[model samples]
Target: MRVAITGSTGRLGRALMAAFGDAPFTGPSGPVGWDRAAFDLDDAARTADALLDRDRPEVVVHAAAWTDVDGCARDGELARRRNGDATGALARACAKRGVDLIVISTNEVFDGTRRDGRGYAPDDPAGPANAYGASKLEGECQATAAYDAADATGRLAIVRTAWLFGPGAPDFPHKIVRAGEKALRAGSSLWAVGDEWGTPTYTHDLAEALVWLVGEDAVVAPGERVAIHHIVGGGLASRADWARDVLGRVGLDVTVDEVPGSTWSRASTPPAWAVLAPTPLPGREPLRPWPEAMADYALSLRRSRTASNSTTRA
Candidate 1:
């Protein structure tokens, strides 16, 4: 079906573009993509009007957000606008145009209480500990409220994911790869948090699942509440584990000095247990293991680095 993706320059947004391309599900989509210039979330009304009134896309993948964890705590109002207000505005516009919206969220909503290692389910209550998490929770609430008020409650599907990896416009995984290269040249090792736990989702896989979910048959069964759904990778992993796999794959042989989250002070608080539960059956194919995903990412980095190196040499 025809779909319009917000924040089309960001990690998951670009992945959605790569996964769906210009002509998704056959035929043309009228092909429109926007970034900070024409589709800033700050311009909520314009963004909404363009998608709802002009493009009239069947699906609006809402991947834009103020994801700066520390900065969010510093200036929460911006986060509220970007995370909550913009989404609320988009949801309202969707309601008016009878379009479905897929809002991608994070797993920081958990309070880190559960230690069963089973991860947090979609039905789990959100008690966010940080400004970033709180703002996202607010966005989820607003999107749902918009649909609920109209009695067409299935329009918004909030997909909560976490520790996302895979290639796209630069993000944490790429940053770490760069840092690792720097550390290797500097004869140093990477320091990672070993205490924090979460699942790492591949961006491409997550985007595919979101596109599929936006097309799924939701019965809107009683008490179902048209609520959030978990779309993260299958297993839980610590940040150190993720780093070790990344560095090891490149044969770096560098030490991953494990440290508690406490050692690395931050402006915002993080939920100690931010793991995302597995997607329900009939979701997507097996979630790619973080190690395997890391290998794939490493290969991508190698290719990109080589291209850059060749250009520089030439």
Candidate 2:
């Protein structure tokens, strides 16, 4: 099972490499790395050609996406092309190649109308509120449509995950850790929004699942139709709680302050409760708790920064 990943440099992409390189075999053909230099996904036809014919990967993980939430609001057109267009092109490429296209979508695609304590199901109606979500939703539509229309439309596996955290890419926890350090230097309490809620997914765990899915031909059902699943961390928590846990793990005694979501307003509206659906994501292991995850992550950042500091001192 040959698996090709589109964005191999990003945080999630790096995590995929790390997790799978350990000792696993997924995909009909062995795993091979693919990234920007290989093919610019913005060019739909060229990208389609590369994925379908050039590499001929049995599974193409479309991890590349325009994930800039605020920037997306300012440039909706670019967002559409990057997130929707790039994803659609790859879906078509996979269809032609008769491979499985794993679309790593986001909870953002659903408008956060679900109650705070409740979880979303795969069949839940989607109503993305912001430009970012709208764009991803469009990708889902195109991906599924391609499969539904064509007999050999590459099998579609649209996996929705959320609140991603891990090393490499500057994701949510990394940003907060950087912020906390800066705030400590300034003698101020770290403040994060407390009201927003969603399940956090560890990048390593999600990558493992993606690779496993790619290896399995069973997911691509009759008609070569695509399958959709929701994969996230085992539980949910607010941004404020997540921050506090991270700070505590990092050995900060300073109280982590929480404020209403309105205080940190952005151009695009964030769904209040875009938690992932638990039902569709089958057989995934329960990820380590958020506190434990933060400890491991914090120490990694510390070790890296400490090494950098020592190098400068020398």
Candidate 3:
């Protein structure tokens, strides 16, 4: 299938590019990428038209969004415009062109109030606790509405993941590693939130899953046009647990002090228990455990530092 990806420079977007490059996606040149500079979401309609007219891709994976949680909380209007309105516009354009669309979303759509420690399913009722979640929920709504309005037969999938971390950008793992090293050098301990918990996903794993979904391998249930799937890391982890694991994996000796989520003053209030139940896809095994994924991430970080040091010496 001819595929195109938006936000091709982002954490997940980069991984998706790598995965698609290896996969057997048929096109004039292979999967086409549109970065923020080339395909601005602000001009969603015009950009979508130009892309569809030029590329005529069979599928478009919409991965671009304003993912800054705190920043979204600061400016709800901006968040809505970028996340909500832009998604609607793109969905409408896709619907008109009869193109399949896979929209990337987050677990924050749920309020995360489940007390039994169970993860939220794809079809669960949504009650966003913050502006970021609210805006994303609106995007989901807008996409669904657009598809329904057009009565489009094309496939529309909402793939929701959580706590993404990987190689491209300075994600949570990078932040923790830097902070841990700093605290160790200062002869102090690193404090991490103990109460807040969620799945820590690796971008590579998500990219592979998305590839499967788009390929002929994945089976869309009969009569289901709009499907929602919670594709996340296999297990759950608290913030402190994640920090300690990351530090230990990297051989950092800094002590991680566990604290409540309220210890830090922030613009956004993340859900405390936002774990997502992984939806089973046919012919595909579930994603590996997060700790296993973290091990690979730690190794990558080590290699990156080694390469950087070598370059500096040269």
Candidate 4:
């Protein structure tokens, strides 16, 4: 099928491109990799025309969004425009052309008010604590409305994930490794928030699942046309856990000081525990544990640095 992906240069987007490259798919002009330069999602008409009239893709995986949590909190209007308005525009465009849309969303939609120690399910009511979450919630609403307006034949799947990390782009996991290394070098202890908890998702696995969802056999059965799936790594972990694991994997001898979330101040307040429960698909397998994923990421970073060093020396 003709597939298109926005945010082609991003962490998840790059992994999606790699995953689709290994699969059986095609795009309008080579692989449908549209970076920010190719299409500005803010321009609704232009974006629609480019995807519908020009490319005419069978599936459009909407992965682009303003992911900077602090920045989103700083400017609510920009967040709404990029994450909320742009998503609505894409959904409408996709609906007009009968193109399937798979939107990548976050787990920050929840306020973490539950003390049950269980992860958030897809059907749970969302109560955003920050502007970023609010904008993403708006995006979800717009996508759902578009699907409903188009008669809801399961043409849309909202995949909500959390704490994504991979090789293509720097993320929280990488930051942990970097911080640990710096602390080790300086003979200092790294402070990590112990109260915050979430499932860390690997982008490569997420990309694979997204491609599977777009396939012919992955359709939602009759009755429900719009589906919401929570695809995250198995098990839950806090920031301190992540830091210790990252340090261990990197062979760092640094001390990780577990601290409260309040110790770190930012423009936006994140959910203390917003882990996402994996979708209960009949035959779907759960993703690998966060520690295993982190190990792989650490190794990959080492290889990347080695290659860079070799190039510099040569």
Please provide TM-scores, in order, for all candidate models, with all chains considered together.
0.90, 0.90, 0.96, 0.93
The parts of candidate 3 lying over 4 Å away from their true place are: 217-219, 306-314
Q: 179, model 4: CA deviation in Å?
A: 1.4
Model 3: per-residue lDDT, tens digit, 247-287?
88877899999999899899999999979999998788999
Top candidate, metric TM-score? 3
Error of 1 at 169 (Å): 4.1
Highest-lDDT candidate? 3
Q: What would you estimate as the lDDT of candidate 4?
A: 0.82
lDDT of 4 by residue, 1-314 (tens): 77888898899989998887777755334358878876686785577667567777788888888898999999999998889989988898787777888899999888877789889998899999999999999999998898889843338888999989897667776677678767876889999999999999999888888777765446454456678899998888998988788777766788989999999779999999879989976666788887777777788867765675588789
lDDT at 35, model 2: 69
Candidate achieving higher lDDT, 1 or 3: 3
Model 2, 212: alpha-carbon shift in Å? 2.3
Ten contiguous residues minimizing lDDT sum, candidate 1: 214-223
Give candidate 1 misplaced runs (Cα > 4 Å): 22-26, 151-154, 215-225, 305-314
| Best of the two (3, 4) by lDDT | 3
> Which 10 consecutive residues of model 2 have the lowest summed lDDT?
22-31
Model 4 poorest ten-residue lDDT run? 22-31
TM-score rank, highest first? 3, 4, 2, 1
Q: lDDT of each structure? A: 0.75, 0.76, 0.88, 0.82
Residue pairs that clash (backbone atoms under 3 angstroms), model 1:
none
lDDT tens per residue, model 1, 33-104: 556676667889776887567776777778888888899999888988889999888888887667777788
- Candidate 2 regions exceeding 4 Å error are 23-30, 216-224, 280-284, 308-314
